[model samples]
Target: MTQPHLLYVAWGYPPCRGGGVYRALATANEFARSGWRVTVLTAGRDTFEQYTGTDPSLESQIDPSIDVVRVPFEWPAQDADIRTYSWLRAHLPQVWHRWRAALDTVTFPERGYGPWRAPLERAARRIQETDPVDLVLATANPYVTFAAADALFEEGVPYVLDYRDAWTLDVFSGVTLASHRSRVGRWEDRLIARAREIWFVNAPIRDWHADRYRVHADRMHVVANGWDPELLGGDEPGTETRGAAVSPMTVGDGDRSHPRFGYLGTMTRMVPLAALIDGWELAKRRGSLPPHATLSLAGYLGYFAVPDPEMLATIERGRAIGVSYDGPVPKQDVGDYYSRVDVLVLALGAGRYVTSGKVFEYLATGKPIVSVHDARSAATSVLDGHPLWTATESIDASAIAAALGRGWQLSQTADATQRDAARAYADRFRRDRQLAPRLRVLRDVATTPSESRG
Candidate 1:
């Protein structure tokens, strides 16, 4: 079959450190693997380093076949450097911020990213001028890329909207962020009205969008985030880390002393870090966990170049009780961090739509996972049947502490057969496994073509 060209428009591609980057990377690479001539349209290195923070190592992991085109982008809200600030911003900061917010909405409803529409459309048009783009897969939540894809659709090209996170719905609260009559809502409606497909990270999100856009509900699909085999190592059924992530708990009673537990991901303000620390302290106070048991954390303190002050303080609060914070794991070395830990912590914000990308990686490790988020999270559905996973009955510290104790017990008691079962569960979520069907359908689009709107 002739290789179909895929223009994957994403703002958070490699080096732009965030949870969504992994899925974007995996999706692009998987398309390349499936014989698509892939072109990744994204923001340049400066945008990440100056605003969102960069993971330089992840850039190296992009597929060699994929051609990445970086465009200049900026986020004024995230600019921390004072020298660049105007007199109004430096002195009348609130006034300047409010003015900036209002100004940003002129081009698009998104504050920091509204202006991105022009650049993305220009780039998409430039790319199309060179050769035909068979299908365009645009990801969110700088949903401006969807506008670019919509622009193409107007010119006869079909596009797919990939919502790594929602724009109109507050995934953390399950509330409508903007009413359908609002500009943001109208913009989303226009984008979804004419698309080949729409993809979401979890079922709740898909269902949420489906409820509103009932007319085009059949176009939506759940293309979930899963662990990248290139990083955490592939799931080989007989391998030690395959059946379940690890078998350290099965290493006998003596090895249980001071077991290593770890949480690896961006430590944002939304996550329940305080509750997690409280639970850890309570666990130690009640002799539920060993005094020397280490709870290590690895990743950024927040999404921006500057860390969240409260998040930093929360990490500090856990220091005295064997909690260690190792900032940012390079993409290549993630497996090493997973290997060093005995248990994985799946701490998240409380929401039915809040499903952490880290959960799939945690499950892939086959380690006993303790859910630190609310029991109501969509993640609970993902981990419900895992042989060695435990969850908080509620988000209370005491409940988290008890869940931790249960997790420790599960790790120690689950035998080889159970561990094998756990690994089998993890296998279902490998990044390729989740994306395979989508690629096949897109392949058909490439060869036979979808109805041309133009």
Candidate 2:
């Protein structure tokens, strides 16, 4: 049987260094493993390395047979590697560039990605001309990727949309997107309506789209994120032994005296860092936490090179309050960080629909989890049966404080039996296991009569 050719469009892929990239990489590899020839379309390596930073280790996980095409994307606002910008754009026309960046958000919800529509559409056309695609799966964040998919659809090609996060719904705010009636919203509605399938990360998000587009409910599917076994299996045991000596990275070195509690992902505005700080202070005030309990945060801030001043301020304040703001840890050292920490902190914004990718990794660690989000959060569904998790109903300082205390107690005394049970729970969420059924469905759909000619 010949494998079907699939064009996977994602703005971020391996080396892009974002949470969504993991899912995109895993999905592409999983499709390839299931006898599909996958070609990933993304921004060029230079742009990726200069703006978002790269993870060379992540490339090891990509299926060797899969083809990836990276096109040049110049987001002047996100270029930290000064060499990326021309002299006129860098020094002479800096004001105009900044103004244009500010206007981009108004043009489209995604700041840097909005202006990428033309380039992405051109790339899709070129790919189609070079190799006729059997199916196209476009992942969203720039949401503008849908524009490329729209082009393919117009050309009688079938496409699926993978919504790692919803565009119209503000998951953190738990509100219908204010721009739901705007031009972009209309585009999203039309795109999803025409696609073969629309993939969401959780049930709540799936339900939101289903309810909004009742006619397309049958097309909506849930494809949750899970731990990558290859990466986990290849990881070394100790966090301290894995990273560069002088690098601004810290991991949970399994030291009971100074046990590190790590949060390994991007530190965004949506994360309730204030509650984390309060909880740490409360643990100190109650004198219940271990003397050396320190929270190590390892990930980028803001979008790409832009740092959120408010979020940075909160991190600095957290440092004064006993939380160590260890800078971003590379993808290769993630497992070491997890191994060093006795407990993991899952701090997220309030939303029953927001089940962050980090939760799966936290579950995979087999360490006690301190969930600092609303109990009604979609993450609760995943951690509900897990034994070592202490989840709170609210993000209140006191509530988080209590949960932290319980998590601390769990860490201090969980037996091997309990730990093993936690590990068993995590085993259920391995990427291959969780995605197998969904991949099968996509494979079937790709070969179905309806998917052949749109």
> Whose TM-score is greatest here?
1
Per-residue error (Å), model 1, residue 420 = 1.6
Query: Each model's TM-score, in the order given?
Result: 0.94, 0.87
Task: Give the clashing residue pairs of candidate 2, or none.
Answer: 252-340, 252-341, 253-340
- List runs of model 1 lying over 4 Å from the truth: 235-254, 449-454
lDDT of 2 at 372: 89
After TM-score superposition, what is the CA distance of residue 55 in candidate 2 from its true location, in Å?
A: 2.2
Judged by lDDT, which candidate is best?
Answer: 1
Q: Superposing all C-alpha atoms, what RMSD in Å does each candidate have to the true structure?
A: 2.9, 5.7
1-454: candidate 2 lDDT, tens digit per residue: 5578899999888888877889888888888877899999998878777777777778877888999998788775655566766766767776767776676766455667777887888999999999978789999776878888889888778899989878888887778874558776778878888998888999999998899889999988888898775565432212343321111112234465676677878888888887788878887677757666788877877656556778888878877556877777767677777777778889887878889898988887778998988787899999999989988667777777788888877887887788878877887676666678767877776677653444
TM-score, predicted candidate 2 vs. hidden true structure: 0.87
Report the number of backbone clashes for model 2.
3
